[model samples]
Target chain A: MMYSPAIIAEAVVNGLMTGAVYALIALGLTLVYGVLHIINFAHGALLTAAMFAVWAVYVAFGLDPYLAILPLTPLFFGLGYAVQRFVIGPASHGSDSNILLVTLGLSIAIENALLAGFRSDTRTLNTDYGFQVVELGPLLLSKPRLIGFGAAVLVTVLLWLLLSRTDTGKAIRAVAKEKLGASLVGIDVAHVYAVTFGLGCACLAVAACLLMPTFYVNPRIGQAFVLVAFTIVVLGGMGSIPGALVGGLFIGVVESLCGLFLGDSLGQIGIFLIFILVLLVRPTGLFGAKA
Target chain B: MLEVRSLRAGYGGTEVLRGLDLSVGAGEIVAVLGSNGVGKTTLNKVLSGVLRANEGEIRFDGKTLTGASSADIVEAGLIHVPEGRKIFPNMSVRENLELGSYRRGRERRSANLERVFETFPRLRERSGQAAGTLSGGEQQMLAIGRGMMAEPRLLILDEPSLGLSPLLVEEMFTLIRRLNGEGLPILLVEQNVVQSLECASRAYILENGLFALSGTAEQVRNDPELKRAYLGM
Candidate 1:
């Protein structure tokens, strides 16, 4: 196939837009892992559930996905808090394998529940701007993708401020670093875990809402994205927030360029190739240290 | 102000603190000194709620704290500065001190922070530096300063001078004495028998998870058997 500068430029832009969505999704996974030290295998499943919730709201009240953010963020936060307090809290002290098994089981359960509840049909949101594209010079950008990208960057900044500047955020960071030491300083470690998990879920709520206008959702859609999210999280360092953002953008660019050069089926292979290469070269990831 | 009776605790199946009984009066600095593996750290863990006591009664300021969560124990003003200077290494000195009052004393956080800085002028200068980068002696000071920020009624220091230089060890003991002089009760756990006895009003020499000797610092320091066993006198 013949390539042009305009084609490459458009691909780069497309890559960045999709990368932002991945970053937002991966941020939730990293935050939970940072404090709880659990991979939260069911994180993508939670995203799928949030998408369905937003979808239901849209179908019932005809509310815009952006407007759905107000209620959904808190709703998922509560859901996350409950899950951590009631489900994961008791088993947290167990061995790593046990926790992994629990999360894996949870992933399967959520996926099955979505399938049972909504069937296997794919669903997409019908927004007025869903198909609209904004022309900039010789390149065109999807309106929905641009909004999603903007929201992702905005949330990232807000999260960074919260973690570095707020008391609650400092407490979360403390718990993330040293659990027993955090208690020595009078931190409620279990409560911190719940809050961190809630925050992670809240990110999923935002990601789900932002993504509705751009992508189709189904029970299995989460699986497609989860591997990519995991790749980004590992590439960025397990719990590094900035690392997730960078990794997501990088992966998006790589996938876009690969799809252009090697065709669609080979795009995922390209991602995995990079994942394995990173794992081989730097097992701790780009930002991670040898733990 | 702090009391632990017949405390029995251990890791999994192996018992460490076997029926250990200890007490500290208000405004007194009592030291629990022991060699490694004798369970001094275990006792601190039990008191701080890091490990559950198999059988014991812990009373702090007349409140039953035997099985209270760490947050509750800390809120009750039984602050434990854990062994090996367990400061939040990635956080700045100020942030580490701020976390000291996460559960209690938050209302007076800024004032308490200033007070801590006053106590350790060196820490004040390095308030923005990461705790991990501080020297061993400074880390211990930071740990204690962080504990003080909680406005602790009773402070527990575990191995505060573990790896300090001889000169720094002297400085640490003097600092502990000054803090105790301010009418704050302290339970100093250490293996540095000589300095600990010198600084503590009363001392307990633990062996096999039980105190083999206990008395006033002068009395214990003079005890022939205690001196020979711990100090190789």
Candidate 2:
């Protein structure tokens, strides 16, 4: 079966758009990993919770998902900070395995709680912009997805500025590199940990808002995105911001092409195959600092 | 001025610093010299709030900091340049220095940065380079420069000369002396006994987690046990 150039272009465009969203999902994971050095198993659950938050507000008050980002971003940030400060940081006690187990346990608890509250039903925002599309040359891109792409990139740029240009961001990088040194300089280490986690969650909140309009959410929806996110984090280099963004887009294109050629289920395998290959060939990741 | 009373600290079941009392008066350079395994680094840790005291009191500038957090201790202007030159390897030299004022010197960060650059002209030259890429001596200079950025009321330097070459070690001692000449009280913790006593106004020789001998530099340097154990007289 031969596909037309138009179809291929559309597929690539779709992948890029989706990849931008994936980058948003990954920004948080990369930031958390860069500082905390832990694979937050609960990241997906947090996404699901943020999606539900957006969904709940939309359903109850008719607030737009786009608008929900304003309130939800900071709310999720606070939530993430509290989780790290109160739950994860204290419970893990600075041990790697303990952090892993605690996050894993938190993931299970959150998923179950969401499963109970919202049940297994898939909820999506049926906004007026839901069916809108923009015509660009021969390709028709979904308006919401385009917004998501621009917004994700914008947020990433903003995050880069925060890290490179601000005091809090410098403190975060310092803590990421040297925790004891960061404290010796008077940065509250616990506070910086919470802030980094909060920023990670805030990224997820924005991603959740972007995804809610074009996508549906259930207790398990975030699991799917997070699996791809983990692949991107590894592919891009664990702690590199640009790596996450580009890795997300690269994986997005790869997944899209794989779906077009190998079918949907196998397309998922394409992601993991690349994940393994990257691990084997370039264990430091594309942007990871050389050990 | 900084004062520690019967400071007792250690890791797990083994005590590293056992019931040691020490102090640094204002405008004084006090050296705490010891050999390996004698709790030099451990005492620095306890004073810097990286480790807790098993039993004792730490009062910095009249504020009891026995239970204070690292940030609180720093806010009190008791800055510690830890052993091993724990500079953020991946960050730029300027960034590592900028982070020195994360707690205490925010308003004067730029000014302190300029002063650091002036003090360490080599740092200014390699300001944009990653710290890990710097030579060993340069990294030590960066570490001390970082501590200076904190506007330290009392600066504590731990093994600042550990890995430097002999010539660089001489420079390190000179820089320590110069910093002391500026009216800053310093607690110089080192294994370099001879130079430490030479550089400090007062000296405390640590042994078995206690101060075995302490007095003015001349007295401690002339002590028979110090000469026998450290100088191999």
Q: What tens digits encode model 2's per-residue C-alpha lDDT throughout A135-169?
A: 99999999999999999999999999999999899
Chain B structural similarity (TM-score) per candidate? 0.98, 0.98
Q: What is the Cα-based lDDT of residue B15 in candidate 1?
A: 95
| Model 1 C-alpha lDDT per residue in residues B99-179, reported as the tens digit of each score | 888888999999999888888999999999999899999999999998998899999999998889999988999999999
Error of 2 at A108 (Å): 0.9
Q: Which stretches of candidate 2 lie over 4 Å from their true place?
A: none
lDDT of 2 by residue, B66-125 (tens): 978888888889999989888988789999999898888889999999999999999999
Q: Give the clashing residue pairs of candidate 2, or none.
A: none
Candidate 1, what DockQ?
A: 0.79
Off by over 4 Å in 1: none
Give me the displacement of residue A103 in model 2, in angstroms. 0.8
The top-ranked prediction according to DockQ is 2
